[model samples]
Target: MRLWHQDLLTFLPRAQILGQHRECCALRGLGWGKKHSTIDYVFTYSVKRLVDYHQLVLREMENRGYKPDQQWYCPEYRGKNTVPWTCTLRDELDDIPDGHIYPEHDDAYREECLANLRKKGIELFP
Candidate 1:
């Protein structure tokens, strides 16, 4: 539902990139709204949603008159680091004890991400 700008230098250096959707994150409602949004999307939705959210964000930017680089990334906005669901105190209350861990514990985070992508019928790569 929100748009985001990417750091073009990190991914691409030629075009402006904006995103229609970004990661689902928890909202603390602090002065940093961008950081809040980034955290909210990651927790609100699955990892795929979070990843695709980044894409949605770009789409939004384009819709708003922002052109993207060949890789479809923005040059003005940067995604700041934030806490993730797995890393939060809530921990893994739904999955196996070990699975509750982040991508490292049992690869659950990554597994769930892939599963979600498949469930969404999304082809991540060209």
Candidate 2:
């Protein structure tokens, strides 16, 4: 699965935004460290980067009046069917990392995401 560029989070359609939230949850949980070509770049950095990126998706969802479970704030809160939370505890991040959350989320990646959306008949203008 792919994370639509963060810049597009605000403009993503409802389905996409929700899908992104699920994607983030998967990445944080069962999908962590799994090699998938579309999102391999995400594994290069700390899991904190994914958490930081997820905050954007959560914010946009909240802005649209959707209330996602706050439990997601924990870096290890995997959704359904997994070990008990206490066994997988991870230190909560105190602050977002400095600079771009993912250095790979550059202008080129933004345009690439936009182009992918266009292919899906979802046109978004920057």
Candidate 3:
């Protein structure tokens, strides 16, 4: 676990090691991939400096049901994640008429859509 945490820290510089836990169920073989034992992890982070931050981002992510722990490790792709993950990202892009979030804006039309994707930390691929 220490090695794995070290590897993750390379990318997540601000990440702090909280703890790890074993999963209760064994993954079953499915079309997605071979089955394996699941391991759960916990992590925390804090901003280096104070700035504008909104709890709305967290709410949007939770509302969108982006459970990486369950989605990445679980063998069965069911429940709230029935659709392909790519499909979800594509759907989000549809909300952006101009399709850019970096250049922040104040337009109300883009507020809901932009906030939903940006606040939730969705990565856009070129």
Candidate 4:
């Protein structure tokens, strides 16, 4: 369960983009605060950070003509089984520097994600 570097969102294949939405939902729901090595850093920040990241995934999905359920916008919205409209206002990261929502998503992490994707036979160039 990794949040692929945001820079790669536009280039990610459909399967990966959809899977990222699911990952965000899981993390925002029961998976919140759970310790998974690949994404442990996520738990260290405010839930808003995840929400902000998920917004990027949603935008990419929309750009590709995929209609993601709007309910996922709420930080409290889990899966379809759970209730939607739990929160109307969402938090946003202020003044994101270098176009990265998270500090950990630095140049090194971006290359790491690219390498990992290459291992899976998916090559995305920035």
Q: Which one wins on TM-score?
A: 4
Model 2 lDDT tens row, 1-126: 899888789999999999999999888888888999999998887777787889889999999999999888665666776542453335554343345678777889999999999998998774
Which scores greater on TM-score, model 1 or model 2? 2
Candidate with better lDDT, 2 vs 3: 2
Cα lDDT of model 3 by residue, 1-126, tens digit? 211221121222112111111111111112123332221111111110000111222223344453334443322222242443232321232222242221233254334434343554742221
Error of 1 at 32 (Å): 18
The superposed Cα distance between candidate 3 and the true structure at residue 31, in angstroms, equals 40
In order of listing, the candidates' clash counts read 24, 0, 0, 0
lDDT rank, highest first? 4, 2, 1, 3
Pairs in steric clash, model 2:
none
After aligning candidate 3 to the native by TM-score, how far in Å is the CA of 92 from where it should be? 33
What is the lDDT, from 0 to 100, of the residue 34 in candidate 1? 42
lDDT per residue, candidate 1, 1-126, as tens digits? 322222221232112232122222222111224444323433543333333335554565566666644332322123344332333322323332332212232344444434544565643342
Off by over 4 Å in 3: 1-52, 67-104, 108-126
lDDT of 4: 0.84
lDDT of each: 0.34, 0.82, 0.24, 0.84
